[model samples]
Target chain A: MHKKHNFGAGPCILPSSVMEQAAQAVINWGGMGLSILEVSHRSPEFEDVVLKTQLLVRELLSVPDHYSVLFLQGGASTQFAMVPMNFLSAGKKAAYLDTGYFAQKAIKEAKLFGEVELVASSKDKDYAYIPVGFNNDKHAAYLHCTSNNTIEGTEIFDFSTAGAPLICDMSSDIFSRKINITDFDLIYAGAQKNMGPAGMTLVIAKNEFLDQAKKEIPSMLDYRVFRDNMSMYNTPPVFSIYVAMLNLLWLKDQGGVSGIEQRNIEKAKLLYAEIDRNPLFYGTADVEHRSRMNVTFLAINKEVETGFLKFAADMGIVGIKGYRTVGGFRASLYNALPLSSVEVLVNAMASFEKIYSDKTVLELE
Target chain B: MHKKHNFGAGPCILPSSVMEQAAQAVINWGGMGLSILEVSHRSPEFEDVVLKTQLLVRELLSVPDHYSVLFLQGGASTQFAMVPMNFLSAGKKAAYLDTGYFAQKAIKEAKLFGEVELVASSKDKDYAYIPVGFNNDKHAAYLHCTSNNTIEGTEIFDFSTAGAPLICDMSSDIFSRKINITDFDLIYAGAQKNMGPAGMTLVIAKNEFLDQAKKEIPSMLDYRVFRDNMSMYNTPPVFSIYVAMLNLLWLKDQGGVSGIEQRNIEKAKLLYAEIDRNPLFYGTADVEHRSRMNVTFLAINKEVETGFLKFAADMGIVGIKGYRTVGGFRASLYNALPLSSVEVLVNAMASFEKIYSDKTVLELE
Candidate 1:
């Protein structure tokens, strides 16, 4: 098999062990003679799985006792509307931090419900850095922010919300680092990135936040409904949840979020250091606010960028092409991405730089 | 391995070959070292998968050219709200056929959008029969109905809709029978029972219906957004869609919808025959309206019902217990249930009835 180093932004790589476990469950779950996909979600087997998965999320994130972990569908995009649908009460405005692509999407959806206050924005610099030093309205219904911008490669590692309830969309960089779970009233992540396959969305919300949600919210979109039904308000994405459960088990085995954080740091550092040293490459996002999950850079020119893409592909490096809006290279070093893969990418960059160096110019031409 | 016969209501049984293919994709898809889970949704490989899956659905259902097939997340329950959210225009009420549990859920959500007229209902008879001979309001925006009630074990195999758009929720018996694609303006099904896993919902809507839908619908919940984006409005439930695609392939191999319909009829006939012959068993649904997918029945007595459950468990039957609201037994014979499994269930019923035949023996005990 021709193995490729996966660096896709989301719907990214997962641990082999987790994949194996998921595959096994697809055929015979715990030797029950029925595939996990075949079993009823309400059955005892799946009930245990759902509960155990919630517990793992709690243990890994050090989630407070009052918080509820729900495995939902529709990705983070659905949560954009659901957060406001549930929490943004009548006559109240929501405070939004316009970080990049996703935050803008959230703001657009929130506008359908109530007024939105743009507390801070990084669009002035093409979202090269996370916005800082903005005063938020304390009376706003909730403070919404994207924890990490996958497309722009900017992250908010340290940010303080005003008195309003903090609602974060951590889709792209969850479980790759440690964060105080109690700091936010609600934190949601699409499982495509550091969590699992693309299908399920993980929502960790405080009990009080859910209790205070509007009762008229659609049952499927209501956080309180999901929390009350244990994320089975309706037929959930069973296979997606099973794979997510396996991934969480793998994350726990990998020493939870704290243990994975150190490894992520090493991998990001290796790739960023090479980008800095290599003459052909330059970092796009501000170095201080650069995302550890997705490391974005640009080649000296479009021709060089195209050439480097071919070189990376030939080296079995996959999904490193930058997002369309950001035309460069994006090496997504998610939790499942090993340091060795980053080394291979770094080596590829070094080799390409050497071959295209100014000293060797015009030799072939 | 404990081999249990899965008769689950949903997240139900699937073909072994389909499960194997899905499991293999979890490891190496088309020998491309990356797991199907790892590939980006925008990647050419996944793009092909998504398009091919839509083609397969169209092919299997013989869906017309003017109808768009969408693989969406949030299940049919989400579609419950989305149906009215998009189709129910201002000042136009929707006509709902409240046949059973799921139908009521749909009505409840529809009420949130506009006035709903309950044209017909089976609630008076504990949803034992599909309501018939009722006049529908053709002037209403749309007529919404659940095609098959999974919990109630009743089906509308011969129902006529008003001149308005016919939106049917075919969650339980979709693809298990031959359905006339043009009869409904919109059809949605949760991909758990006869389709695949639970994460995805299959929506087949006439292109014109989508074009005329409310423009203000949320992107994720809007059928037009999904159609315009080819169901890639966001990161879709990837694994779920792939499995559904695989199941569609399997269905084609089993002779598409027609072949599966034949098998389904035979399985239901076999179980119902046993219920009729056995002294202990009596079907709960009206004889004329009994569902071919879900065959609900009850034992002669409460003690016998409890005893048979334990007996069925010892005989390796799983998920045969009726829905909580409707107590007894509900053998969900979905598309994947083999005639042999139904025969086994029939034999178990016969054996149980013989062992508990004497009515006077209970008093002696």
Candidate 2:
């Protein structure tokens, strides 16, 4: 097999070991002679799986006893509507921080339920920096923010809720960092990035906050329904949740979030350091707010960018293409992305610079 | 490994060959050196899988070109809210047939959107039979029904939508039989039963009916959004869809829906014949409305029922316990249940009757 480096943004890489175990379970689980996919979700075997999965999420996040960790469907896009549907009732306004594409998407969905207040926005500078500070509405339904911007590669480390309850979409950067679970009322993440696969969306909501859900919300869209039923209100994404459970086990083995966070920091440092020192490349996001998870940068010009991408592919490194809106390379260094992969990318960048760096290289043409 | 027979109502049995191939893809897809779960949905590999899956569904059911087939997240329960949210605006009514638990749940959600009319119901008999010969409102937004009742073991073979458009939740008996595509405006099914696994839901909607969707629906909940994007409007249930694709391929190899339906008929006939002939057990569903998918029945007493359950378990049969509300046995013989499995169940029932046929059998203690 070729040595491949997967840097795809969302449905990204997972630990190789986790993939192996998940594949095994896909064939036969618990020696029960049934694939995990073939077992009934209500059966004792699967119940153990769902319970173990939830327990792991709570343990990894150090989630409070009053909070419910739910494995749900519809991805973060569904939560974009569910959050506002549950919290932003008629006549209530939700305070939102418009950081990037996802935050803007959330804001649009929130607008459907009631009034929405844009507390702050980084759109003025193409979302290259996370807005430093904002005054939130203390009486608003809740304050919502996307903790990390995948496309722009910016992150907000500070999420001081002040007097208002906080709701966060940490889809891309969750589990790669540590945070106080008590600080937020609601947190949701699509599992493809840091958690597991594409189908399962994890929702951790404080119980009291869930009790405040608007009456008459559709049962499927209501957080209370999912939390009350232990995320079994309907048939869940079984394979996705099982895979996520394996990933959580892998996370715990890797010294939990703190241990992975340290490795992530080291990985980001190695890649960003190479970008800073390389003459042909320059970081895109603001240095202070650059996302450690997704490192976005440019390659001087289109010719250099195209040449480097082809070069990376030739070396069996793939999915390093830049976002459509932003014409620069983006290497998503997610939790499962090994430090060795980052070293390879950095070495590729250095080699490209060594061959192309010259005072009159373009003039020679 | 222990021999096991899975009769789960949903997340039920799939063809052995389909499960084998799906298990392989979970490890490495098409020798791409990436687990199907690890690849991006936008990748060419996953795109081909999704395309082939859709084509198979269309070909199996002979779906019209005007109808768009979608593989979405959130299951059929999400569609409960989405269907009415899109079709039933204020001042309009959606006529519903309350046949069982799911139909009631759908009605409850539709009530949140607009007026809901109970066109017919078998709830008086605890949904033990399908409601037949219902009058429908031609001017209503739509008429909705569940094609098969799993808990009650009833089915409606003739939908006959009248002049109004029909929406069906075919969660349990979707591919187990053949149907006319033009008879319904929309059809949705949770993949746990006859399709593949939990998490993914299939939606087939006529283009004109989709054009009538209400404006301002949440992007994730709107069918038009999924249809327009070819079910890639969001990160779908990738693993479940892939598995369902394999199951669909298996169905085609068995000669599509008509072939499977013939085997389904034979399987149900064998089981029902034993039920009918056995003096110690009896079927719950009315003969006229008996389902070919789920065969529900009961022993003469709780003692006999308990004894037979243990006997079935020892004989490698599982998930045959009846729903709590109904209580004795519900052998869900879905599309993948082999005729030999039905023969096994029939022999078990015969042996059970032979052992407990006498009136003094319970009194012998």
Candidate 3:
């Protein structure tokens, strides 16, 4: 029953305890003798789930009182359209910074809502770092960024501060690090990455940003609709939220965000150091803006990448294959991934180098 | 443990066998040594899950080649918006028949995208039946209907044709019946109900309707994105899809839609007949429009309702409580619910009636 340190991207590894608790709830939830999935979302049992999740999120992230936390259905992918649809009424254009594949998707979704100006993009350099030279467009309704690029293994170390109600798709990095809530009026993440699982998108939006929801907004898509209903407008993925609640509870038990921040820093440091110290492996992301959650690397020789991946897979390791959006290895170290797992991954890498080198030595001998 | 037959609403009952399969997959999926949740959705193993689910759905429902099946996150609630955003273009109005709460929510969402007309509504009778007076708006985008009203226990026995492209929200009663896919251009159901669990929404749309997707639609929300990527535009809810797959497989093994429809018809009949036989309880909804999915009723004496519910709960009956939107008792008989469970409910009802009658006779004496 030992869960392999699961590193699959989104719908990714959850804490063992959270999974166990979630599994139990699926059977006899809160002693109600009903699966959490079958409970009325409006019932006090579920309402408590909604309220406690919001309160815990606020407490963990230090969210301001006015900011609303919505437990939405679609992952951040849905928010890509929603952000502009609800917020794009004021202006004809919105500023978009494409840091990675997901940011590009958000930009594409935003354009459907309004005219999009590409203020900056790192696609020119294969999305290895936060794009530079962002010229602010004051007329733009909001500025958008993806805090952590899951595919490209890069991140925005510090958010751009030109500040037109900064909107960020923090799908991969929220709850992974501490953030100043005041800097961004709207920040959202698909719960899968660091929070819990797929199908739940966690959003924290300022009250002002929400008041901008156009009158004809789709009642279900309307963030305000969720705000009014406390995200129970219609059955809001009860089991997902239930599991997410357990994850948030697990996060709190793990000493909240700050405690994990220190551990994640060390996990990232150890992996990156091994990648850098070894000549057989190559790190992809820019040194200044590497991600703490996913480590991107490649075998120095591309011909053996498949063999190396296979070798890693044979050794109780899985889901480390890089996103096809970027071809290489991506070791996603989310909150539940202990430093021990990172050591396991790093150990495999060192052994990989030794095995390949010794094979060549044996041939020469 | 003894898992009660969960019958709340959508996210209702899942087959115990399916739940057992899900429990097994949580640890080792497809002999992959990783939890199904930990598999890369982009990988071939999970792709089999995504593609095979569509195949099973097509086989089970007899979906045509002209139709495309998609597994998308964001639930049916998100579909309310996507349906309009995509189809309601070209200055055409969309006609939505509001049968109940979710239908009303969908109507409100349609207005956000473009012109929307309330073609029919049951609100006059508190959504007791599918509304009357269908109009053929020659220029309308689609005529939308909630095939089954989960909260009100009302349903359209078959698809309604209003001389426009038909869109149906079959969230609560999709797989329970044999659906004519050609009658509706688009059909969506959140997997919680008869489909499987929560998080995933099953979208079956005609290829022709999808071909008409207007440009500038958010890539993620765009049916075309899912159509093109085969529902992997982003990481799908792998675990949810896997569960749905198992549920569908189980459905097929039990003789597919025809078999399930027969069983469901019988279960609804037996329970409704029992309710009608008893003077103490009368069924909700117009008899002609009653739903086979959720059977709702009220006691002649309001005082007896809670007692009945508590008494039922004590007998391992879960999700018997009606939606607070319309309180009484609702026995949801999704496809996963066995006819034996309905018998369990009927026997409990008879026992409750007997116990209450004896107590009343004692008091009178």
Candidate 4:
């Protein structure tokens, strides 16, 4: 089989070495003569897997002892509801940034629980860039923001809490970059993009912040329940967490988040440069706010857009299609996506450009 | 390597063929040249998987068109909250049958959203049997019950709604026996038992019943959202669902639920017969209400109990430990567990009984 370059967004690529090991573990985990799928979550072997994965997340992110790392299910979408259920009561207000599609979703769920004050919004500009210099309610229960917009191909490079507890949905760009854990009271990411697969959501939150959460909330939605029980309040997504541990081990060998960030930067720079030089194509989203993880771009016309997609597919370049709302192409350069895959995508663009340029000259004649 | 017999209560055994296919798909799914772990949930390939799995569930169970089958996250624990959040309001009372540990848990979450009336309970007898001959409130919003008590080793053989809609938590005994889908307004099972892995939950509910659910609930917790979106409101648990589809396929090959039910009966009879005949042990739950899925038993004495467990372990029979609250032994016979494995467990029991009987005679001498 030929090497296929995968760039799917969320449920995205993972290291080949990790995939190999994960496959083997599914068959016989730790030589226990049992498939990981069939192993009891309460078993010491799986418990160690959960513990080791949490430790790896802590070591990789430099998480403080004051914070708890939980591997929960229901993805970040569940976190959208859980964040409010835990902190915001009917009387209190929560501040949220309306930067893109996901941020708007977080705001929608928060509204179900309490008052939501929009701190800043880039919705007016189609979420092309992050908003700046907006004041947040210091007295609000918490200030929520999305660190990266998977759909709009924009990222938040800077964060401000404005005296409120900071909660960020870092779903798309979690392990792709480095950030200080102390700056935010809570951080969550669905483990598909940079972490592992789609079944688990990773949560890192301050223990003190959790203490103030409203009492008598649904236990499954309560972060305190998960924190107290070590995320074993129920049978967790065992295989997903196991695979995530393998991927995290791979990330650590590649020198952790800081190391992967450098490579991600290089890959993004290469792809964006080609988009700039290619006459047949133009990059979407503001250049200043362009995502290093998901690079959104468009062909000059609809004909070229259809033509180039087919041209690229023939070369085994898959999962570069953009989001539905944004009708162009999105090449997701998540952490596991190698520079070589980006080079293949860039070459596909260059070759398509040359063909289009010749056709345009002929049509002009 | 020896063939190990797995009798885990849940997250137990899966077909060996299903595990093999699942492991291969993790590396290269359907020869798509990409790991199933890395594929987009929106892609045609994965959409087909979700569709096919739904179809298999519908076909295997003969699900009616008025019902929707959903593959969701958060397990049945989440369903415990969602059931009341959707149907039960603060003023409305929901009737509950407190059968065992999991039934109590479901009742606890429901109380958070509305008033709960305990129609009947077996807790007075340490939940050794399912409650009987109790009348539920006909005017209650819904009647809730657990079909199987995983911890206490009891299963409900008969269901009655008392004119209200019926909802069941069938997490541990979902596919092990045939049940009329039309009998309940809703049925839910965490996939770890008879279905698949731990990351996904399977929900089957009547569309008409869901239409009456409360409006403006959090989208993720709303069954209507999953039904409308075909369980794709967000990225589903890809690998878990894939493995489930494989296991469901294996189940279909074994002649669907009715066929497996016969084998399950044989397996249960073999083990329960051994427990009844053996002088060193006695069954835990009431004889009539004893679960075919989980057969709980205890040794006559503590020293003999410890010795028998070690003896079973040495013979490569695993996951037979009972629940903490009900200390003894529990050999779970899920759908995928073969009768051959049960024979090994029975042989181990017989061999230990012989040794214990000889030791008793020697002590008397």
lDDT to native, each model: 0.89, 0.88, 0.83, 0.91
Which residue pairs does candidate 2 place in steric collision? B11-B192
CA error at residue B20 for candidate 4, angstroms: 0.4
lDDT of 2 at A19: 84
Q: For each candidate, C-alpha RMSD in Å? A: 1.7, 1.7, 2.5, 1.0
Give the range where candidate 2 chain B is weakest over 10 consecutive residues by summed lDDT: B356-365
TM-scores of all candidate predictions against the true structure: 0.97, 0.98, 0.94, 0.99
lDDT of 3 by residue, A1-365 (tens): 44576667766787777766766665567777666656667678888988999998999999999899998877887888889888887546888988878887788777767688888888888988887767877667889888898888898877657747799888888998899998898999988877876778899999988897677776766789889988877667777777778888889988999988999999999999999997788899999989999889987777558877888777777788887767888999898888988898889888888888899899899
User: How far is A144's C-alpha from truth in model 4 (Å)?
Assistant: 0.9
B354: Cα error in model 4, Å: 1.0
* Better candidate by lDDT, 2 or 3: 2
Please give the clash total of every predicted structure, in order.
0, 1, 1, 0
lDDT of 1 by residue, B254-283 (tens): 999999999899999889999998888899
Choose 2 or 3, whichever is better by TM-score: 2
Tell me the docking grade of candidate 2.
medium
Best by DockQ: 4
Q: On a 0 to 100 scale, what is the lDDT of residue A319 in model 1?
A: 90
- Per-residue lDDT of model 4, residues A155-196, tens digit only: 888874557899999999998888999999999999988888
Residue B192 miss distance in model 1 (angstroms): 0.3
Worst 10 residues of 1 chain B by lDDT: B354-363
The regions of model 1 sitting more than 4 angstroms off are A362-365, B1-3, B358-365
Candidate 1 TM-score over all chains jointly: 0.97
